[model samples]
Target: MRAAELHGQRHVVVNVVDDVPPPKPDEVKIRIGAVALNHIDVWSWRGMAFAKRELPIILGAEAAGEVVDVGDAVEDLFRGDTVAIYGARTCGTCAPCREGRDNFCEGPQAMYGFHIDGFLRTHVNVPARIAVKAPKGLDVMAAACAPITFGTVEHMLFDNAGLKAGETVLVHAGGSGIGTAAIQLAKAVGATVITTVGTAEKAKKAAALGADHVINYREERVEGRVRKITGRRGVDVVFEHVGPATWEGSIMSLKRGGRLVTCGSTTGVAQSTNLYLLFQQQLRLIGSFGCRMQNMRDVMEKMAKGLVAPTIDTVIRLDEIEKGLARLEARDVFGKIVVAL
Candidate 1:
């Protein structure tokens, strides 16, 4: 088996091992097909695991693979089934997990490619519950982006923000992996999408993805453009993941009683808040983490139907993953970078 192990900051070594374990009673042995790169992978590469973790951890979080072996207790999955592996390790029996709120599980949670060994290897054993089977005929590369990329957007826009049809949404970083997914998903629900991009090229691509309006944040005041686009009103929802750099503007772009849902802090974390404006406007701020297991299924189904698909910026072999991480860290990618295993 071949695996990419991170020993320290910017140190990734691909190792070959002779021994690999089989699946447990409730687990499955997966032959990883493709691994999608996320900002979380960049954070891990930079030695930014916020929690305590041991060194030399495998370095992939979002991936899809073929099931080579299934545990005796796992009847839903079978040999040769293609599935997207969830990044977080949550106790399936926890109240939140049972209630379809897997991200809020009370048990000890560990994120793959961060706190624990990930799927950047030839094979891995994972709990069957976290392995979401992709719809038949969906390409493995596209399925690789579902667990985190599309699922996170699905959870953020619909579950956390309660985004509805006939509404307007401001999605920051519109050229990003999740941002591109947000634009398509929001539009599929009939929402008017306004997105922010850093470059004119990204602005064109964002608009092509069905964004009603695209703002080049580097060239103009985002909040000012957003207000003008809305005719001095504001958007019904704001899909925010870029951190403090855009935090204040994201707040100002939202309408009264509107929702702001955030999932990541790619930029620096802390930012000042206006409590008076928040209270007066009755705005809702939602802090969303990972998605429910069901969100992964929903996105995969959408992918199968050709309603949405991943925007793959590049594909490289596992040994070349460092280049992808560098691109993600530099904000040089338009969508996902997948590693063919």
Candidate 2:
């Protein structure tokens, strides 16, 4: 078997390793087929992890694989089933986990590709409880994206923000994987989408992805354009991720009582907010992390229904992990970069 591991900061290597054994009871052995790259992978490569972790950690968070074998206690799933592995090491006995809010697990921090060995390996044994079956006819590349790209947006827009049809949304970094997903999902439910891109190329791409309006933040005033497009009413929801560079604009672009859901801070994290507006306007600021297992399922179902699709920028081999991470860190990609095993 082969695995991509992070030896240290800016150090990624593809190593040949011993194959994983058969699944233990209540577990399933997956033959990983595809791994989707996210900003987390770039963070790990750059040693931006907030917690302590061992060196030589496997380096992937989102992936889909085939069930080569299942433990005796595994019931509903069988061998040969294609499934997406949840990107967290959550304790199932916790209250949050019991309620399907696995991201808020009360036990140890629930993170993959950071705290524990992740899905970049060719084979892995994961608890059957964490594996969600991919919908039939969904390709491995697309299914791999559901656990992170689509799931995060689904949780942010619908669950946290409570976005409704016909409302307008401002999606920051529209060329990003989750940003692209947000635009499509919001549009699918009839919400008007306004997005910001870093380049003219990405602006055109965002328009093609059903964004009602695209702002080239590098060349235009994002907040001014958003206000004009919304007729000064501002957007009902602000899909924010870029940190300081767009934080003020995101707040300024929202209407009174509007919601803002954030999942990442790819740029520098430090930012100050207007306390007066925050209280006076009754604005809601929500911080979301990873998605629940059920959110992954919902996004996968939507993918199966053609209501959403993964926008893959490129597919690289396991050894090209460093190159992929570099592209992501440089923000050179317009969509997801997948690694096929």
Candidate 3:
């Protein structure tokens, strides 16, 4: 079997391992089919990780695969079933995990490609508890983005922010992977979507993706545009991910008593906020990460039903992963970059 391992910053090696290992009593042996790249992969490759991790870690966070073998205890999943593997290693016995709030694991914090070996390899065994069955109509490439790209938006918009139909939302970096997901999902529910992009090309694509209003942040101020588009008022919800660089604008784009949900801090983490505005507006700021197990199933159902679609920018071979990662870091992509195993 072959696996791409990250030894240090800007270093990735394709190494041939011994034979494939068998699954444990509660695990499933998965032959990974496709892997999706996220900012987390770029962060690890650039030595921006803030957690404790050993070297030579397999570097993929989101992926989908087929069941080559199932453990004796695995009952629901079987051989030849295509499934989306969850990205985190959470304690299933915890209160949150048992209650389906998987992102709020009460046990040790572990994420694939960050805390432990990931699914970038040809063969790997994972606990059957975390494997989600891909819907019948979703393909490997689209399923690969569900675990993170779509699931994150599902949890952030519905669970945390409670975005509703007829509402208005401001999605930052609307041309990015999660940004594209946020825009489509909001629009699918009849919400008016306002999105930000860096280029006119992306702005045009975002409009085609059902964005009601597109703002080129590089050419104009995001807050000013949001206010003008909303007729001097602000949006009911703000879908935020770009941090620090657009933090103030995100805060200013919200209506009174609006909700702002964030899942990433791509630019920088340390930033300032105004206390007076925080209390005066009665705004809700939510910090979200990952998603519930049900969120994956929900996203897959939406994909299968054609209510929402995966916005894949390109597909690359396994060895071309480094090039894909470089493009992701350069912000040269409009949607997701999937690497076929």
Worst window of 10 by summed lDDT in candidate 2: 108-117
How does candidate 2 fare on TM-score?
0.99
- Candidate 3 pairs with clashing backbones: none
Q: The CA-based lDDT of model 3 is what?
A: 0.92
Runs with alpha carbons beyond 4 Å of true place in candidate 3: none
Where is the poorest 10-residue window by lDDT in model 1?
Answer: 14-23
Worst 10 residues of 3 by lDDT: 44-53
Candidate 3 lDDT over residue span 21-68, tens digit each: 789989999999999999999998887658589998889999999999
Q: Global lDDT of each model?
A: 0.92, 0.91, 0.92
lDDT of 2 at 177: 90
| Cα lDDT of model 2 by residue, 1-341, tens digit | 99998998999888998899989999999999999999988888899759478988998999999999999999989998999999997889988999989888898874778878888999999999999999889888889998889999999999999999989999999999998999999999999999999899999999999998999998999999988998998889999999998999999999999999999887788899999999898899999998999999999999999999999899999999999999998999988999999
Q: Estimated TM-score per prediction?
A: 0.98, 0.99, 0.98
| Candidate 1 segments exceeding 4 Å error | none
**Taking the candidates one at a time, how many backbone clashes does each contain?**
0, 0, 0
